[model samples]
Target: MESSAQLVIFAGLAIGLIYGAVGLLSGFCLMSSMRGWLAEGDGRLVRTYALAVAVAIAASQILAGGGTVDLGKSIYLQPTFSAPVLFLGGLLFGYGMVLSNGCGSRALVLLGRGNLRSFVVVIVLGIAAQMTLKGLIAPARIALVQVSQATANSNSLPSLLATLGLGETVSRTLAAAAIVVALMLFAFAHAGFRRSPGQIAAGIIVGLLVAGGWFVTGYLGADDFNPVPVTSLTFIAPIADALQYAMLSTGLTPNFGIATVAGVFAGSLTTALASGRFKLEGYSSPRHMLRSGSGAALMGIGGVMAFGCSIGQGLTGLSTLALASFVAVAGILLGTAAGLRGALRVQPLAVA
Candidate 1:
């Protein structure tokens, strides 16, 4: 590996460590937030999520605007995308999140605390993701994406605004400001959220980490001879890749995602041990295990189909202001809503 790629891998480790620590401390998770707000009538965590989104948008756009990172290089900004596939995938992922009681990132954090249930989730999810990406499911996913993909001259919000005769800088500025302001207002409007400084800091830190990932790949990893992929903090494909690397260490070179995955587990374990929170846990019943396994499979497939998961599309992809990211996120929110309310809602498991 080139020196730059090695540096990027190490950077990924650092970023993942910070994320794991912060996530454990603050319990920053989209599924938890949705369940809290929709099922339990608590909105403070959702507000914290909103703040994170706002900060991510602000920081990412600023980096793009300053030419530090080319947001266009990211996969989310592809000129042609399948809205139907993305939406459907998001729905699957969101519903699966509820079934598993968390998303991929959350499962990783929980596993660090010695949650055996999360170990099942992580393994199943990784296998499923790999299947979707390269195994039996890959052909179907590729065909679906190909059949439904739509091409556009402007694939992103800012670019669309520019096509409407706005200057590039002005369009980016206006779109980012509008969205950021709206999210910030929603986040800060709640008195409960405002009173929780820890939640506030978690949001800010997580958002900055997203931007940091972009910088690591786009700037520090830039090379003429050996260029690293331009990506941020995404979990779906990375988890699958991590699993593959673990089994085939001699043949495969370690990348940012693999290093990050390892870092997250290590970081979370350290934090858990330090805080006396480490405990071995498993499913309450066979039925519970089955449900979690199913959810993990769905998350793997859906995340691959949609091109991301909650943290992937919701925070990292959206930070680039990609139009497809919006559609995917809307689908995720709707799916979460479906799981949290209405006839399709998943009932809480009975306590034994």
Candidate 2:
């Protein structure tokens, strides 16, 4: 209805388009990256992910520092959060990712490429996420959060530093710089990774997309009459919301998330067609379908509890340097490790 909201939606579309194209071309999925690095002994993809995180932090903090956006308004910076719930959610989501062989965003990309199995995953995940967010599971999720939640005066790392005598700007800059430097080092340490320009570009573009989403909602969409929600690129809630909006278009107005989700699908489809890579694919067996469906359910439920998916918490949430984000991410990493290694590891499915 509002002009600014329209602008935000259009901006979201553009960001999603770029992200879809880049993701399709670069194979940028956290599960794939982790599998490559840990399971396959290839570190280039993981390094690309690390670089993206580093760049996202740098770019997002710059926007905040310039007063272009209020990071405080984002969900990651809430004054009260349940660390235990978030961590558990992250674990569930991570393990689900491994079971499903990818996360929500990855499933979207695959769907764009005509993967019918991803279609199943997307549908199941959306329904499950919606259930967790506002349907039957909402009560349990709410009860758990209420029981485990904790409140704090400083909800973010920079804000925490601010209370320790540093100026607001200084604290933000210091924290961002320290984290960025460490991530960059990890991203660039490998010679193979350093030599790959395509992966490098993918990281940079994806990171900028995260910041771009923030700018679209926080700055461009800021209106005195009807302000858009201050958010960045994340997949879990958006996927559920998208599915709802698709069915209830007569009553619901599209938001940035829904538009972005559509854009990702469209963008990926265009890319796949153009690249001659589109192919219809399906599950190899009934067991594969069962595993995939189960995994999607976990992702939907866990993502809701954690307040984000892998790309959501791993990149966008981390950009805010929120303490809860760190806890969630740690849980995600641990969960992924469990799935990728040890006796609990998910074994590869045999082709039917």
Candidate 3:
């Protein structure tokens, strides 16, 4: 492998380890946030998530400002985005997340803790994602994307602001800073959240890791001869790629995404073992497995259609202030609400 590829993989591994450790330590799942906020009236976890988003946006924009990374060249910043696909994909992903009781990242964390059920979810999700990305459904997906694209404008917050007569740099700074500061105020306002060290660490560490991912792929991984795609800690395609690489590493070379995926599992497993949190778990019943499998399938398909998962659109994409990111996040929020407390809710099983 090339030395730069090695550096990129190492960077990915470091980011993944930090993310896995923090996620495991803090119970950082969006499913928990929805459940906590709606069912249990708990705001701590939700607030922590908000803090993570805010921090990610601030740090990532700083990197962009310093010329460390060109955030505009990212896939998230595409000029034309298919609104229909993004909404549908986010809805499916969010609902599936609730059904499986975790997102892709959470599944990796759970699998690391010896959860066999998560193993099942991971496989199903990966295959489903791979199929959506480049299988039988690709034609239909392409057709829909081509038809429903909202094209013409810049499709970014700063660009839109510039259209309104603001300087590009000034607009980006104001847009990013205002959002981050508002989120920080809301996140820190809660006395309970302020007192929890674990929650604080998770929010800060995960946020930085998102920005760190941008740094790894956009800066460290940049190559003139063998250019790597500029991206960050997105799980959908990467999960599928990791699975494929596991079976075909002889020919296929390791990249940041696959390395990050592997690193998350390893880091989570190490933490689980060291902390004695590892435990064997499985499906509650055939019906439970059915629900989880179905959800996993939906997540794989939807994540591809929408071009991102919860973390992808919710935190990482949003950090760039992309309009499509907000739209996707709204769809995810709506879908999560449906699964958690709306008409489409999957009833929870009884706790033994």
Candidate 4:
């Protein structure tokens, strides 16, 4: 059992590294995609992100259907519903990502590019995330969770389909196929989108990474004595956890999400150094720095409330087909739109 556990840890780390590298290379960022669609009228990046969501949903469902994993065990599919918190959290996180000019994952990648501004944003985000997760704001979050709890089934669409009288296998298969087909059609329909290999590959690989995370924790990390939390990619809390781990390594064992977050910074650094993309860039003015820091702080608090950041809820949570995730995603979209329009127009910082 000890050896098996060790193997599982190693596998999880490997998956994290691959995810980091792929994410860095492909520039997979939900905030950037939304901003591009809203500000520039370029929908390719958004389409790629949508494609990844669809793929993640199909693949994760297939894993659950095969009995290799149980999607219900994940946090996103918690039986207790908190609609208000999820929506509000999503809005905060989405708006913050716009102000910061990137989401958590994007910050990691930018950190590698030697962007000192992103480093500040990431550090603030991590610290704030920790505060919301288990620090000063924890009690408030706990109270909210308690107040808004609801009893409901926490299964994927396919599982719901089974509940509705469809055969389990057929329902799972059909649901997965339908989503995959729809996503593919959307991604490939446009000539320009099809030609952008970077965007397309990012969608596919990131989708696979979400499934890989599930396999790591849900399958490999399942131990009788010390089972790991069934989770996948999410930047907010993990960044906080990573900070905590650095300070209290003796008290906490390394988890998959923290390890993955660390891997992203490392991977991006490696890629940047090798490609000569590394540079020391910081905020041009104090006001700009303040804006970035405030954005990061909002993301941390919001991510905690929403239960995820872009990759967390957008890809990982949605892959499970939880109704809450859908709500959160919708909130994120709405928030991003608001940020990109009207008085919320914040100047975007140049990529470092």
Candidate 5:
């Protein structure tokens, strides 16, 4: 049994490394997709992002139907719900992403491209994430969690459909098919978008990566004696945890997410160096530094409040079809829009 568990852990590490490598290489980013669509009139990235979400939903639901993993075990689709936190957190995170000129995932990708600004954003985001997750701000997070008073049983749409008299298998299949078809249709509807092979492949691979994380942690990492936390790619808390782990690795066993985070930076650095993209850069002005720092802090607090960052709740949590994830995604979209053009607009500044 111990050997079997070790095998599973190895499998998870491999999967996470692959995900990190692919994400760093391809520049797959939800924040960028939405921002491109809204700000630049380039719909390809957003369409690709939507397709990835659809793929994640379909693949994850199929896994659940096959009894390969239990989606309900993850936190995003908790039995209890928190509408306020999800929406509010999304709002803050969305604006922060724009203010910082990228989302958490984007920050990682840019960090790989040898952008010092992204490094700063990520460090601040990680620390703020720690504060909300288990640091000084944890009490406030717990208090907010307590106040929301929302509830749900299953995380997927199938679970909700099951309560309406649909059989589990049938509900899961139908729900998954619907989302998948809608996303595909949306993606292919645009002639320009369909022509972008890089974006399309990025969408598919990244979506698979999200589902892969689920399979690794939920299925492979399951152990009776030494259980692993059910999680997928989420940058905010993981970054914070990664920072802490660096200081206390002796006391902490490495987990799937941490390994993946490390792999992304290493993978990106290697790619950058090999491609001659490596360069040391810093903020050109104190104002720029301040904006980046505050944006990172907002992302940390908001990501914790909402329970996941773009990759975490948006992709991983969505894979489970959790209602909370859906709500949170909606909030992220709204927040991103607000940051871009809403009353509380956060203008994008150039990274130096």
Candidate 6:
């Protein structure tokens, strides 16, 4: 038990450290990438995001193919997928992330750099996620899940392709390769993106971290006596878990998510301090606080509903080629666009 726990902790922290360092350096926010593309007509960052996703899928699939990881055991590959939860949750999370000026993962990084406003966002997001997960909203959320859930032949595209008559290995290989190649071509086609090596490295590192996350949890962390849930980078539930662990650690054992959450903060803080970027920051007005708080709440609730946040469904879950992840990512993009231009825009800076 102790050895397994130690290994899980070590694994989680290693991956988390890489995530924090690379994420901070790269400014890897899916919401920001979407905004850059839609609002600013800039595709460079978006391409970076694509590269990360592409690399993650290829690397993870390779692991699965070689039997280094059991991708099916992950929650993203469940037989039944909650379409409503993913779509609506992704929508809310997208808009809320925009409103907060960052996603949940970004908030953690910012908080590490002494952004008190991010602290508020993190606290609200954590509490709201807990509420949606198991607090006051759980009943309603579960009811929604029960009604909206649909059982699929398989949630993964490769599996679906296999079922449609292709050889299983061929189906998986072809699908994964196609997506990977397409995304890579798209990412590299941008001349500006091609010129930015730092950004490219960032994308690759982030993607490998996702694959590393799978390897750590699925293989190294897997144990019959003290099993850990196989998962990768995600912020919603883990934020809540971190909060709960801080309060009730005596009664609860720290898990991968919680450890990852803490490592992100620690890693970011260290990097920020070393880079001389640490500075105290807070809301400028009461209105700013209210706006940020509302956005945080929305992110928490929406992330749980969707079963993951931007990075969760966007990079990690999508890496699995899960159908629900596709829908959820689409919803996130749509919602982000809506928030950027439509009447639903949560523009506290401009609107307030």
Give lDDT per model, in order: 0.93, 0.94, 0.89, 0.82, 0.79, 0.88
- TM-score to true structure, per model: 0.99, 0.99, 0.98, 0.93, 0.93, 0.97
Residues 71-106 of candidate 1: C-alpha lDDT, one tens digit per residue: 899999998999999999999999999899999999
Candidate 3 per-residue lDDT over residues 1-352, each given as its tens digit: 7777889999998888877877888889788887898988888998889999998999999998888999888889988898878999999999999999989999998899899999989999999999888988888889999899978487888888999899988999999988999999999999999999889888988889999999888898888886677888889899999999999989888888898899889889999999999999998788888999999998999888888888988888998899999888888888888999967888988654
Order by lDDT, highest first: 2, 1, 3, 6, 4, 5
What value does the lDDT take at residue 127 in candidate 3?
A: 96
**Model 5, C-alpha of 62: deviation from truth (Å):** 1.2
Candidates 1 and 4 compared: the better one by TM-score is 1
Off by over 4 Å in 1: none
In angstroms, the error of model 4 at 350 is 11
Error of 5 at 47 (Å): 1.4
Model 3 error, position 266 (Å): 0.4
**Predicted model with the maximum lDDT:** 2
Q: Which window of ten consecutive residues has the lowest lDDT sum in model 5?
A: 1-10
Q: List the residue pairs that clash in candidate 3.
A: none
Model 6, position 196: C-alpha lDDT score: 94
Query: Model 5 TM-score?
Result: 0.93
Model 1 lDDT on a 0 to 1 scale: 0.93
Which runs of model 6 end up more than 4 angstroms from their true locations? 348-352
Among all windows of 10 consecutive residues in model 4, the one with the lowest summed lDDT is: 1-10
Instruction: Give Cα distance to truth, residue 192, candidate 2, Å.
Output: 0.8
Per-residue alpha-carbon lDDT of candidate 5 for residues 120-156, written as tens digits (9 for 90 to 100): 9988999998888888999987888798756666656
Against the true structure, candidate 4 has what lDDT? 0.82
Report lDDT (Cα) of residue 62, candidate 6: 92
For residue 255, give model 3's deviation from the true position in Å.
1.0
